[model samples]
Target: MRLETEMKMLQAKSQAGIVKEETVGNASRFIDVSAKHTKLPHFQDGKDDLDIWLTRFERFAESNSWSRDKWSSSLCALLTGRALGCFWRLSSEQAQDYDKVKLALMNRYDLTEDGYRRMFRS
Candidate 1:
């Protein structure tokens, strides 16, 4: 009777282990729908975080086979704060234009003077 109970307990533990292994991969998988919207690094204006955001965005674009224009617009979805409002005001027609969106973002979020200095020195 003891050996039978121990065998049943081992079987239950093995089943639980299999379940955990299967769930680990599903939990970690990320779907990049226009940069995964939620995962885009917040680009607060004048912060030293655009480089980080750009690298992540680039990876997202490549993984999802998105064009620069698509990236340009989806980027608007990731905006927060005053920046989010700025993108919202864009006319649907204007929003369809990638250059306009990109230019607007660059104008608002251009790096600080220190960033330029660092660029020139390197």
Candidate 2:
């Protein structure tokens, strides 16, 4: 009975995830990112606010049922100019290596100058 209960719970969780996916667009690339001025699905430039960009980017990634690799790859492809340049000469294709891309972006853009100081001091 305990085993059966656990199985049912797992099934329920999976079903819920499916339902959520449907709501977020189970099809290809949730929003027409190319059509938008931001060029990143629901994201906006917002004076290069990484917080706002990350939030929208995450939602976009999730909606398209992307993995970490896919998330990094897609974002890398869409980013251009200074935003794209920060990847240390790595292009969208090379930056598909999720961990490396994520680390570089977060270290440079996500963290404030003070945050970096605190990180090193700690």
Candidate 2 local Cα displacement, residue 36, angstroms: 14
Write the residue-wise lDDT of candidate 2 on 6-118 in tens digits.
65765565554432212345542223323433346433344556656777887776775666756776776666555566665766566768667666766666476787688
- Writing each residue's lDDT as its tens digit, candidate 1 over 1-122 gives 99789656655654543211223645522222333344556666556365466567778767765666577677877777766776777888778776676556555565446656777888
Instruction: Go through the candidates in order and give the C-alpha RMSD of each one to the true structure.
Output: 12.4, 11.9
- What are the Cα lDDT values of the candidates? 0.61, 0.60
Model 2 residue pairs with clashes: none
The TM-score measured for candidate 1 stands at: 0.46
Q: Count the backbone clashes (under 3 Å) in each candidate.
A: 0, 0
Clashes of 1: 0
Model 2: residues with Cα > 4 Å off, grouped in runs: 1-46, 91-94, 110-113, 116-122
lDDT of 2: 0.60
Instruction: Give all TM-scores, in the order shown.
Output: 0.46, 0.47
